[model samples]
Target chain A: EAGVTQSPTHLIKTRGQQATLRCSPISGHTSVYWYQQALGLGLQFLLWYDEGEERNRGNFPPRFSGRQFPNYSSELNVNALELEDSALYLCASSSRLGYEQFFGPGTRLTVL
Target chain B: QQQVKQSPQSLIVQKGGISIINCAYENTAFDYFPWYQQFPGKGPALLIAIRPDVSEKKEGRFTISFNKSAKQFSLHIMDSQPGDSATYFCAARWGGTSYGKLTFGQGTILTVHP
Candidate 1:
């Protein structure tokens, strides 16, 4: 089975612009999650989507939002991106609600 | 209260040696602990995981030792190889509210010298 897959391996944007990252979960997986990994900082949970609904989100600002599709794929949208938002955005998928997550290669977003 | 603390920011282990990484969590509600290994420019892959009920779980050369009383867990890699060099992360998840959202620790970079 294929693991989680992400799009736009690298993305570059300027301050105040909007950035969208996409993730396709593995087949038969129903839960999707997003995480941000910044330099020197550990992975920070961003969002969780399951059954096409937003389940939980981290302490990030309102600008960081995302939604899951019926197929379990997810898209993370960062509005008014800031320099601090420049980081690797990783997505993961799990078969069930509380199962082990399998991660994708992640999309590296660079905000200037 | 959801923080997972990991130690030894970096480790240098000789090939054929044992590599150990430790993680301590403060949330007693967290019942699932997992370890991940990531290569440069790649996403993390699940190495092994354990539930609070089990004290230890071993798979191949990887092992997870969980101490529920102390709220700590560790990953042990026996017979380490050069290919085993990578960044390792420990994560925890609770059952109440987060819905499997994981709180990860600052990763530990392991370098196995041949």
Candidate 2:
């Protein structure tokens, strides 16, 4: 089975611009999660989508948001991106709540 | 609040030695603990995991030792190898919460010299 897959292995954006990252969950998975891995910040949870609904979120600001599609794919949208917004955005998918999450390669966003 | 705290931001060991990394959590609600290993430019992969019920779990050369009362846990990589060099993250989640909703500690970079 194919694991989680993400698009745009690397992305560069100017400050105040917008960036969109995409993720495709493994087959038959219903929950998709977004996380930011910034330098020295570890992994911070960004958003969680399950069963096509916004289930939970992390401590990130409003500028960070995402959605899950009917097919279980996900998209993370960061608007008015700041230099601090530059980081590796990781996507993970699981078959159910509390199960192991399979991660994607992640998109490295560089803001200047 | 940095609910989970990991120690020794970095570690170095010789091949054939044992490498250990420690982590502690403040929330008593955390019932599931898991460790992840990541290589440069790649996402982390689940290394080993343990539920509060078990004090320890070992798989091959990797072992997870937990101290429920202390709210602490650790990962030990036996027979360290050069290829094992990477960043290690320790994460925790509560009951019924999906593993995606994890609280991660600052990663520890492990380097094994051949």
Candidate 3:
């Protein structure tokens, strides 16, 4: 089976601009998650989506938001991007009942 | 608050030697402990995992020793190699959370020399 896939392998945006990143989960997976790996911050959970609903989110600000489609694909949007927003944004997927999450090659976002 | 703490921000070992990375978590509610390996410019991949119920779990050349009573876990790489050079992360999650909502360590960069 194909693994989780993300589009726009890398992104560049200026300060105060908006950026959107996309992800496609594995064919049979129903749950999608977003994570941000900023410098020195390690991997921080951003959001979780299941059944087309926002299930949970991390400690990030409201400017960091995302949605999951019925097909289980997800999109992460960061508004009013700041230079601090530069980081590798990863997407992962798993079955609704599973604990194992398979991650995709992340989209590296660089905010200038 | 950082729920998970990892020791030795970086590690270096010779080929055929053992590489050890340790992590401790404060949350007892975290039942699933996993180790992830990440190559530069790539996403992290699951290397091995263990639950609180098991004291140890081993895969080819990779082993996870779990100390549930101490709330600590460590990853041991046997016969380390240059191919194993990368950043390793220790993560924890609560059960039944579907996506698992990982709490990750600061990451340990491992460099293996020939």
lDDT of 3 by residue, B1-114 (tens): 999999889999999999999999998778788899999988899999998999999999999999988899999999999999999999998655433688999999999999
Off by over 4 Å in 1: none
In model 3, the Cα lDDT at residue B102 comes to 89
lDDT of 1 by residue, B5-113 (tens): 9998999999999999999998887879999999999999999999999999999999999999898999999999999999999999867876588999999999999
- Which residue pairs show collisions in model 1? none
Chain B alone, TM-score, model 1: 0.97
Best by DockQ: 1
What lDDT score goes with residue A5 in model 1? 97
Best by TM-score: 1
Minimal lDDT window, size 10, model 3 chain B: B93-102
Q: State the lDDT at B10 in candidate 3.
A: 99
CAPRI accuracy category, model 1: high
On TM-score, the stronger of 2 and 3 is 3
Best by lDDT: 1
- lDDT digits (tens) for residues B34-90 of candidate 2: 899999999999988999999999999999999998889999999999999999999
Return the candidate ranking by TM-score, descending. Answer: 1, 3, 2
Consecutive 10-residue window with the lowest summed lDDT within model 1 chain A: A93-102
Candidate 1 accuracy as TM-score: 0.98
